[model samples]
Target: MLTIDITGAEVLGQQGFHRDGLSLSGGLIMDAPVGRAVDLTGFRVLPGIVDVHGDGFERHLAPRRGAMKQMAEGLVAAEAELAANGITTGVLAQFVSWEGGLRGMDFADQVFGAIRDTAGGLVTDLRPQLRFETHLLDDYAGLPARIAEWGVSYVVFNDHLPHARLAEGRKPPRLVGQALKAQRNPEVHFQMLLDLHARRAEVPAALDSLCATLADMGVQMGSHDDHTAEARAAWRARGVKVSEFPETLEAAEAADAAGDVVILGAPNLVRGGSHKGNVSALDVVSMGMADAVASDYHYPSPRRAALMLARSGVLDFAAAWALVSAGPARALGLRDRGVLQAGKRADLVALDAADRVAMTVSGGRVSYLSGDIAARLVA
Candidate 1:
């Protein structure tokens, strides 16, 4: 096993920063001497980020419509991006939804197969997370076995349908375009949507059953885009404890009060607010309601958001940084690799003066090394 000692950097300790730096050997932080020691002065060393939910890899996987040909290549590219962004453990949120195309069941199988095949070669710990659309009742029965086959331990429930308009008998905007993307006739797709909408009352019971089955399988589950406290409470009753990207403060407070983890998108923080005009992540963080932040659709946002939070003076570095590191790790039941302490996994990222990742080490193995940092290590 490779050993590396990173010195002359301000390492993040349990309370705050430590000026003495740290050492890594045999894939864990250690006090004993090891192999090479790289001088990383003028840098800040912290735990590698753990992204609990993110779909940014979709662009790399498909790039363009009807263009996906290789999953392994896409996964490799995604892993490189993750490592470059200081993410050691990334939960790739793959959709098993009604949107069809890349988000459909067939494509999800391909992604799962490719992920399993590429797992051994990946430097970052890439985990699969199923974003299941609640209205896909037919898919629910087979999900348990499918999840087990894919080695997926995390699942998030989503309902992206425009229920209000559909209930009013209004066709969804761009209905024809959506149907074409799903390879279905516009009329047929509209009927399908209407049929699902009519059966809305059945959804809760079905979701409860599905959640029960998933929980029995030892899968961690969360609900996405929670809009109300009542909706969040319903999901919570079914054992879906994580509230992902709640759109209202009441919803977020409900999750917090229930002791469920509240996850906001990192992009919301970096962009100053939600583009969809939902709740502000900054407000959630300030109120101490947000427990963690995911990269969501942007790979670079986690690091930038953490730093930005500190810059805004709303949170100290330790508290702000934990949203991307320790908080997310703990949310996903990963008790290791999110802290820069002895006896823990040696997964750390070093940021240069410009706040870019200068180096990233996952499991004491250098996953990303760039610019002057690479030269110093080589020398």
Candidate 2:
């Protein structure tokens, strides 16, 4: 057991911190009498960020064209980046697509193995959230088994190919460029995209089975890019309580009405636009349509996005912070984290005025401080 006091820090969304201290014991926070504490005057002490969706680790997975990095190295670098970005509990969105290339099943297996092995020792608390492409229905049967064995925290259904089918010839050149950069043959990719859409009749049955299996196993389920109220209703019926990146205002509203947690990308809020030409996150937040805002592919955006939303008057600090913190935590059913309450796990971050991470403490132990390792525990 260890005890330290963080005093004079502003606790976001709460009454200003008294000139007292926070105490940690047995890896859980305990209230103690106020005393002379380490003064953190002028700084904000927020609950550690709980990032439900981030794929920035992909940068390390495929650092360059035709180059494959080792999972251990990528995990180390990814953990460092997450800490620097103020993410304490990070759910890396590992895409196990049917693309049949570097971003496919083998890569997912390796990364998932690394995540399971390295999670306890990493600078940040790392969890694997599988981003499953529905067209990968051929592999769906085995996923529940794998998730049961591996213990994944979250699962999101990505139908990028469905949207691509909708775009077809009107597809932007940048998307094509991205495909090429990933070493995918354009014709083959286009054919597969078309084939996936043509096979839509098979999707609902496969997805229903998969969702039911995961629900029975107590795994969290999320639907991505829901475009219509009907689409949202269908997912809701399947026990998919999370709506990720709803593409239309109607979809978001419908999810809200259905008591689904609507998750938007933090990058969309920070950039003030969506990369895929969907509904803007700022608009969603202003309309009270968003429940959680994830980092998505950009690890640093959630904290900055929270501040940006506050400054833009879309939400007050408490409401904006909830999108990145407690909202996502509750969405995933994470019981012990995402808030700075007494008796909770002392997972927290110290942030400067610019919303940059200065220190990150995970599970009552300092894991990362700025650019250095604050605590090193080997698993």
Candidate 3:
């Protein structure tokens, strides 16, 4: 364990700014000093961002098609980027879906195995969130065991099928491109889709059964792209308490009403709206429907989004920062990190006057240090 004392930097916690600064020792925050004090003037210290869900690392893992031969190297690069952005804990969303290649079950096995094997070497606390496609009915029976084998605690159900076209008994567009990407013949892929669609009526029962088993195993569950309040309610009944990126305001509101955490994309806020023309995260934040915001496809968006919210007067600094820190931490049931306080995990980030990440400390270890901050620490 490492001990560090950061002084002169304004410490921001859930309550507000602490002028007295703070200290870290043995991987936890300390009330009294246990290490040499370093003056971090002209900086602000806040809890390191807790990203509940993010798939941005996909590019690092598979930057180009057929370019990835190993995951360990990619994961290392991903952690560097995460620490540079002040993310202490990140949930890497890996897919186990009908779509083959990177999103396929075979690839998922490689990812999960790499993560488990590389856990000891990781500086940042990286966890896996299995994004299981709901239509893979055959996988339902074995998923619980596979999740345990992979040491994954979080699972999110997603249905990426073109529901309107499928419901109309029509083949979804882009079948050839999708098949080529999945390394399958277009005709075979089309047949697979049709076969899966025909069993849609049986999906609900299978999903319910799987959710119950996961609940028994104490795995946290969530649903993605919920489109309706009724759909949100149905998911809630199956013990899926997290609503990730609800496509409609009504769905988000319903999640809140049921006391479920509503997660929105931080990029949506940074860009002012959803790229897909869905409900705006800014609007959801304003309506008090968003419980947390994630990086989504961008590693730096969480920090940028939080600062933007504060600068725009949508929320005060403390409240806005919470959307990325405490809010996501709590949503993911991570009680140990996300807030700056005595006895908590010493996962802290130091930002310069311009709000750029100058130093990041994860578990009391300096994972990233830059500019004058790095020079000062070295000296």
Superposed Cα deviation of residue 18, candidate 3 (Å): 2.4
| lDDT leaderboard ranking | 3, 1, 2
TM-score of each: 0.97, 0.89, 0.98
lDDT (Cα) of model 1: 0.90
Between candidates 1 and 2, the one scoring higher on lDDT is 1
lDDT of 1 by residue, 232-339 (tens): 999999999999999999999999999999999999999989999999999999999988999999999999999999898999999889999999999999887688
Candidate with the larger lDDT of 2 and 3: 3
lDDT of 3 by residue, 183-294 (tens): 9999898888878888899998998899999999999999999999999999999999999999989999999988999999999999999999999999899988888999
Q: In model 1, which runs have C-alpha deviations exceeding 4 angstroms?
A: none
Indicate the worst ten consecutive residues by lDDT in candidate 1.
1-10
* Native-to-model Cα distance after best TM-score fit, residue 248 in candidate 3, in Å: 0.5
